[model samples]
Target: MTQQEPAPWDPALAPADADRRLHAPAAARNRDAILSVLRSVLPPAGTVLEIASGSGEHAIHFASALPDLTFRPSDPAPEALASIAGWTTQAGATNVLPPLRLDATDSAWPGTLPPGETPAAILCINMIHIAPWAATEGLLRGAGALLPTGAPLILYGPFRRPGRPLEPGNAAFDASLRERDPAFGLRDLGEVTALAAAAGFGTPEVIEMPANNLTVVFGKQAGR
Candidate 1:
């Protein structure tokens, strides 16, 4: 018999409340820092599509902070979708829509968006290194097809940068990730940028984020 794939990370901590809300420790620690960068980059008003929205904590927090923008959070996991719905109901955030069950590797991603809602920007946090490389390729391909010119595709995670040594913490994290799944590990920033460029994105702006992570933003070019 084939061995079952290990669940991603540890089980999330849940509260005593009857709601399906689940908490990811990292989400609480990094939400504010990520929000600070988002405030400057996201458009003033419109929908934002978030891929692999694990635990749904970020979606509620960001929606609460940026009331003008509508947030559509999606994940492939059923538990994550339940958690997102639970958080949305608990927070009473009108700007956040019901979470979609989306898979990054799907070629028909545009069809998954809610009717009459074209995202002004796409945000993916802490996804790349934890999944297979095909997921990243599919994400770029889908974002390229869905976003209009000058729209942004923002990615947040730990990356291996050229000519710079990995911090001790990130190094250990990378090792742990690889140990979890051979396909999982830190991706090189240069390769990621190149992949985005090929998908019709312009040169990315890399920002230094707390906890040795980085936020990379790529703008869709005028012409494909």
Candidate 2:
């Protein structure tokens, strides 16, 4: 069988340890900022399903800080799953569950969760822009199926906003992403919002973050 190449954005740094914990430099830089928004948006108590949880650093940090809420981190890569498990053990974070092997493009995602553990929120950080558009579509569809009315689906990433020129850094980053994979590049915010709306979500609340990133929150509509 032919081996598939790892994603260009996959974490490449790791500490010298047997537990297989990988490190992403960006995760450490952005976790606290992401957590700040999560504090006010997340449900007080319930599971928060995180998709494409790259290095597991964000999961460990968030789980440690938000002990009231359980975090379920998942990724499609075997290395990523190992890294998440390693970080969970290293941090001794009881709130963070073992990582699941989940692909954002999979239609069977609703069945991938642990029994009776419906998530109160779904979070995807720095994923859509690095993944195929189908992943974004599938993510919305899965979140729509799983979350209860009024639950939030939060996404954090660089996006192209209508009328606003892309920030220089983000513009360069977008180019690099597309150079690596033509299907991957910053998505237009208006398009993502429209897709969410079609999937039974309300208009999103867009919050600006450091490094030209955004935290966009869409709530599941009632009676959908």
Candidate 3:
């Protein structure tokens, strides 16, 4: 997927109490493509907790499409949470829960789960490369702790692979991200896979996506 400049939500950007809907220009373009991969990997009837859910547009669209699955979208920013709620409300998405404040780097993930609700899948899109390396580690560790065997932890992003030439767009995107924050940039796929294996996830099924993005599907290992 194409990278958007990372900015943690600012409540001042919009009014929380208003019936306004925050829009991400890219969400509409990518949601359908991402949903196709999700449809193949996600469980039929269980909660899907999406990390760093920007704009909440994807959450609403996915929830509407997969009525059998409950969608819980979370972000670290207050404005993002409000936007998520607004979108859910506007869409009348019964399958979506109120957005939770979640920081991917924090060990205490999910902080407040819906009562008696455990995630059947964890969906993270366009987050890792925009955040610190610690966040990716935290995501894997948290998924190891929270997911049961056979449950998938799905990640979508652009990554660098060995012996493969980086796309010009992605190369520039990586440089721009690093210029924004030294800690954030495109990560090596090998390192990510090794980390996931160490975190008790089996080998990932890498699917090519539009815009040089990849949908990496990894399942929780039993009794790790």
Candidate 4:
């Protein structure tokens, strides 16, 4: 599960003639480890919204692993959406819905109430550092609106730990990300915690994962 196979559902026709930024390989390598952590943090079964589902790799893997849970994969980019559809076509996965056009910074990110209720979970992975600060704030604000009193908002990514010497690996990774785009770099974990707290989420449960990244679980408190 650590290594992702060639995506099973890439179509011959380019997904709307767009440049493809392949991210599934890395996502494949990390999906299982992430799922292991998710099992402990999430409700036994529910709908999950995965923001920024690049290359559609994680959506495929997670949908296969958690059949009881329906996964909603979303991305702002059209090419990514195509790749997700291609993957879905190949896997014939009933648990994963068609890719949703979603952007974290947008005030109206699309999501629907279930047959009679809101989403059971909101899952975002590797999004904050790649986008601007506004996206991060919007993600928190949107999470507060979508989840119930005791649901969870799960985020996974590499982050800087305040007051600690930077791990060489993380520092180098940060440098590489910034090189790609100055606005993209490692974010501070403490700041994320503060943002979550302000948005009515409880203290985050942080778990160390592969690649020096982490899984931070923020649950909506019971009475806020």
Write down the lDDT of every candidate, Cα atoms only.
Answer: 0.87, 0.88, 0.85, 0.78
lDDT of 4 by residue, 1-224 (tens): 12212222233422332334344455767789999998887787888888888778787888898889888888887778877887887788999988888898986764433345367898888888878878888899888877888899999887888898667777776787788689877789899889988889988898988777789999998766
Give lDDT: candidate 3, residue 30.
74
Local accuracy of candidate 2 as per-residue lDDT tens digits, 1-224: 11211232465445524778888777887789999999999999999999999878898999999999999999999888988998899988899998889998998987899889899999998899999999999999999999999999999988899999887777888888899899999999999999999889999999988777889999999987
Better of 1 and 4 by TM-score: 1
Candidate 1 lDDT score at position 192: 90
Q: Order candidates by lDDT, high to low.
A: 2, 1, 3, 4
lDDT of 1 by residue, 54-167 (tens): 889999999999999999999988888888999999998999999999988887777898677788999999888988998899899999988889999999988899989887
Candidate no. 3 TM-score: 0.91
Clashing pairs in 3: none
Give the top-scoring candidate (TM-score). Answer: 2
TM-score-sorted candidate list, best first: 2, 1, 3, 4
* Clash count, one per candidate: 0, 0, 0, 1
Q: Which of the predicted structures, 2 or 3, would earn the higher TM-score when compared with the native?
A: 2
Q: Whose TM-score is higher: candidate 1's or candidate 2's?
A: 2
Rate residue 68 of model 4 by lDDT. Answer: 90
lDDT of 4 at 180: 68
Candidate closest to the true structure, highest lDDT = 2
Per-candidate TM-scores read: 0.92, 0.94, 0.91, 0.86
Give me the runs in candidate 2 sitting further than 4 Å from their true place. Answer: 1-9, 13-17
